[model samples]
Target chain A: MSKFKKKTATSQEIPTSALPDIIFMLLFFFMVTTVLRETEIKVEQTLPKATQLRKLEKKSLVSHLYIGKPKQPEVYGTEPKIQANDVFINPDDVVLWVNQEKDKLFEDERDQITISLKVDVETKMGIISDVQQELREANARKILYASIKSVDRE
Target chain B: MARSKRGEAGVNSAPMADIAFLLLIFFLVTTTIATNKGLMLQLPPKPDPNQPPPDINKNKRNIFTVLVNSQDRLLVEEQPLNDVTELRSMVKDFVLNFGKPDADSRALYNSLPNSMKSQVLRDPNSSDHPGEAVVSFKTDRGTSYEMYTAVLDELQGAYYEIYGDRVGISADEFRDLDRKNPEDLAKYEEAREGIPMAISIAEPSKVGGE
Candidate 1:
């Protein structure tokens, strides 16, 4: 009777110890297989409000251009003599950067290019128009303007 | 070391193994994995009953249809354009020479008798003189957004030059000015209302040429 009892107790303990190992294996599998979503740049733009906005079905290639305050110029003296920069400048530099990196992002097809402009509401129309003009010169079509809907306050 | 026959009599091992086998098979069949690819575009669908349809078919001769496929080639009507700059010239010529509206229609239609005015009311592909020129942009699926936007910019620039507002007036300013002066309002109405340069966008039938 003692021997039989000892055998039963050992069998129960074996499965209990194996439970932790099984759990660890499952966790590892999930960690390795899971695909993380791509990171998107954050831009401040007040989108035109539309009640009938629909989600896009087909996937088009998009390059993002963020138009906001220009970077502060480097100061040389105690009293920083401000050098004037073009206030209404196009995001041509960004476009050039995107074009340089296009090979990695876009496949062999040329027509698949899409450029989305994310411009702040305060941004002048000239900036947007200039950027659009540059894009035209680049022979890039499939343009979209990105805007966020304003939330209604109570 | 000898087998314990007395305790083994009640053991039923076959059913437990069968259950484990069934569980494995269930998981194997149910599990699915997918890979994410490409950009997403929400296309405008056919307008609802309340929405007015913009006439897409104006004069066939003046109407320059540019189709940008998912591959980024520019097709004029069905033929590919050799150079991109040609688009601007084509649009310029069409707008400049848009013929006068018919005398009967001018009298019967709204007060504005300008070609630009008539063009706004006419379909893009309409064969009539003074009919508005239509520029149709049909993009294929999986096409990049950057390319499409560039085309739009080019078209807008061409229109802006012809309309005499290199920096086009804002919508708000135009609306405010619309109510103040009758003469200015008429000109604005004629420019804005008549077959203004129309842009229509369409998607290809299939994705990625498949």
Candidate 2:
């Protein structure tokens, strides 16, 4: 009969001594992996879609070149402009910009630096070719035509 | 008499977990994983301003011209192709045209899937081997970015498919091959040792917007 009685001799609550440690582990993970937004993205972007794509592994070795309509059409005009960092510069300025980017990196990493062209889907290839021409002039030939993943095969 | 003999109770740590959870939830909500991936391409080196452009005479069979007009229409090998998906098979067939099947050529033929093996449509007038084949992708200024990427995707996919077949893995696995892993790096180098992807992007036709 005594065996059938309620067993409240010890605390029924789960031992939560490791709860803080577990939470802290997850907290550190989030802290370490977080990459805060650096660029303001002055231009309006709608990335094109593609199926076969390679992930850009090293963030330090990439120069982002944005080609899209200005977010405020009235101020910057409707024409799709080229944005490198903060300013929307002319196509010819790409040489200076690319060279500056190359200069910022270490000597060994300079040659391997890739230019990522994040262009709008609606954008015409005319301005894009202009940027490409400037890229050639800059001798920064390695390019990654940035795109989102697509469902369709094409 | 100077000191009280009463025992002190333990401080509560229940609120500490709650605080950590709040911060975790904030980061989870605010932080976005950067999804930066794309089709890689390499442009030709800048031509010397002082010297004349060297006009190397390439065999007509070796050059595969794909023209994308301002209207987003595709002209593949001078033939109008409506579907971009068809480019994959066309490119594979063109790349693997090993004329005069020897030991090396026979081995290449075996790498292709059983489905593709059934179609004996090798062009004698086209490229002799993967080494000589060049796919020249030409676009018009007015061509939309979507169409250009769509076409480029199909072209690159063909090469990746071939590489995956040679290494006995799927195309997705081939793309995800990390150099950090020795086995993966070996597989990658083995698959693409001689058959380099030589898709050249020619100058675009100046037609549209600034």
Candidate 3:
């Protein structure tokens, strides 16, 4: 008779103590993998596209120089400007800036450090040549032109 | 009764998941996983003002000149080519002429496997061989970076495709050959021995824009 009697179902609650632990683990994973934005880009940029693009293998070994017209035309004017690190710089100052950046690296790693030219498509070659000349003067020979993979339309 | 009261006073962690979800959503919204990639080009050493440039006796037939004007027009070997996509196969044909055998041609293509040798198309007007072939790239000051890179891509793509075909591999695989691996390193070195990238970028013309 007792066995035949209906047994009340026990409400089983899921243990959520480990939920915070899992979340914390994910948080740490994200925090460790996130690359902080290197610099605030004041210039407008639309990277050119290409087929023979190679991924820059090491983030630590590359420094970018942004060249484009300023985003805020009212403030910075329509003329293309060069932004090295976090500051606006003249093309003449590239040598000094390259030297400064090179000095930050170890001697063995210095040669491997690439100076990536992030130039807008519309930017003229004059400034680009000036930057290239400055880079040559500074003995930073490796240059990577930033580009994306072109779709059929482009 | 006191124990019951203590159990009732336990910390509420119901909002913990919500908080974590908010943070997770924030990171998911703000962060990008893909890395930026590009074309790696090595600039020639700075020229010395005191030193005169060496004269090369390269025949006009051997030099494939590509000019990008301010209007983004592509001129290949002095002939205006309207479509950029045509540049790849055109360059490949120019670089791999199998019509007549020369000393340079023999030296360049002799090492390829027999299976690959049969694939070279015979063209008398194109380059004598890969070694003798030179692709000269130049651009006007007003030429957009897009056009410049597009031309460069086609040029390099030509070499990569040739190398890949000779080695019986894809271009991406050829590029991914790890130097750290002995077999891969050997294959890469062998592939590079024949179709060396010989694009010479001339100083951009100042005729376009100031």
Candidate 4:
């Protein structure tokens, strides 16, 4: 009975030598799968809703342009603005940005690249048209208007 | 003999879990799964201001016009339409009009294949045919993006429904058809045989506040 009791006591304590290995495996999984946010969003954009929303297939073939009011309304006021990458840019500068972005991609992939316009629904069409004009000037014909799926469509 | 004594102790692995935990926390804080997706639309070529506008002398009956004002009100063929959901059914009806044989065009309802013949109705006032049908969308400058996209969705939905019906499949299934597959590509082609996507977005009018 004493021997069996001793055996039970020894088996009760669990082995933790493989704990770090398991944690490391999970760490690697998250490290590979997670895509870190590239830019700090300054503009407050609430995307419009639609039923015909399509998912963007490739990430590398797309660039995002944010248009809306600034998050910090006190400093930037309530007027809508345009945000490209890390800086706030004027509408005319969109062409230059597109050219620069196109140059970053390979020659074959440049034509396939799509520009995603993330705009607030309440924003006026004046700035949107200006951006579209600039995009045309830059020869970026494919435009994706970022929108969420409407909840009631289901 | 003294050098052999240094092998008595092994490197400690107790801190490995702490290091891994720290990394996991960092990644959890810094990483964000990308949820960005949207409605894709191709823009037309830049307009030449010096050039004169092209003449549109076609039958007004063939052109299904939709006007969205600043107040987000929709006007279909000069009639005020309140509900956005009703827009798709209206567009579908106009596109698949199956009109009578006029002096210039044949009867569109009788020209369909054996498959699509039963699904469509013959209406002399609807349209000459799907091929001749055109959807013209005009939005005011003050129209919200939400209203614009909702209207656009209904327009596309109308075409999708017609295409799905012709192909004998659900509209969602038709929309999700894999173009990369040869069979799906053939179905898509057959579905869009006479009906082309003829949505024309006109230049915004200055009716609302800029």
Model 1, B1-210: lDDT tens digits are 356754665755445545554554554454433212112232333345587877755446656677776566788767787665577656655554424556643543444334434344343343233244566766664344445554654565455444433124532233234334787666565554444656655534354541
**Candidate 1 per-residue lDDT over residues A68-142, each given as its tens digit:** 433332422221111112222235554454465355454665555666555444443334444554565555655
lDDT value for model 2: 0.86
Q: What range of 10 consecutive residues in model 1 chain B has the weakest lDDT sum? A: B34-43
* Candidate 4 accuracy as lDDT: 0.81
List runs of model 2 lying over 4 Å from the truth. A1-19, A151-154, B1-9, B99-120, B180-182
- Error in Å for residue B48 of model 2: 2.1
Considering summed lDDT, which 10 consecutive residues are worst modelled in model 2 chain A?
A145-154
Instruction: Give model 4's share of reference contacts.
Output: 0.68
lDDT of all the models against the reference?
Answer: 0.47, 0.86, 0.81, 0.81
Please tell me how candidate 1 rates in CAPRI terms: incorrect
Worst 10-residue lDDT window for candidate 2 chain B reads: B1-10
DockQ (CA atoms), all models: 0.02, 0.68, 0.56, 0.58
Instruction: Please give, as one word, the docking class of candidate 2.
Output: medium
Better of 1 and 3 by lDDT: 3
Residues A1-154 of candidate 2: C-alpha lDDT, one tens digit per residue: 9889987898989999899889988988988888887888888889888888898768899999999999999999999999999899999899999999999999998888899999998888888888988898988888999988887654
- The candidates, ranked best first by TM-score, are 3, 2, 4, 1
lDDT, residue B159, model 3: 83
Q: Which parts of model 3 are misplaced by more than 4 Å? A: A1-25, A151-154, B1-10, B98-107, B113-116
User: On a 0 to 100 scale, what is the lDDT of residue B27 in model 3?
Assistant: 77
Backbone clashes, each candidate? 43, 0, 0, 0
Candidate 4: segments with Cα more than 4 A from true spot: A1-22, B1-15, B100-119, B181-183
Model 2: per-residue Cα lDDT over B93-177, one tens digit each = 8887764455765676677567546653567788867777899999999998888888888989999988887778878789989
lDDT of 3 by residue, B25-129 (tens): 777676766446888888778888899988888877778899988888988888899998898888888787655667765866777777667767777776767
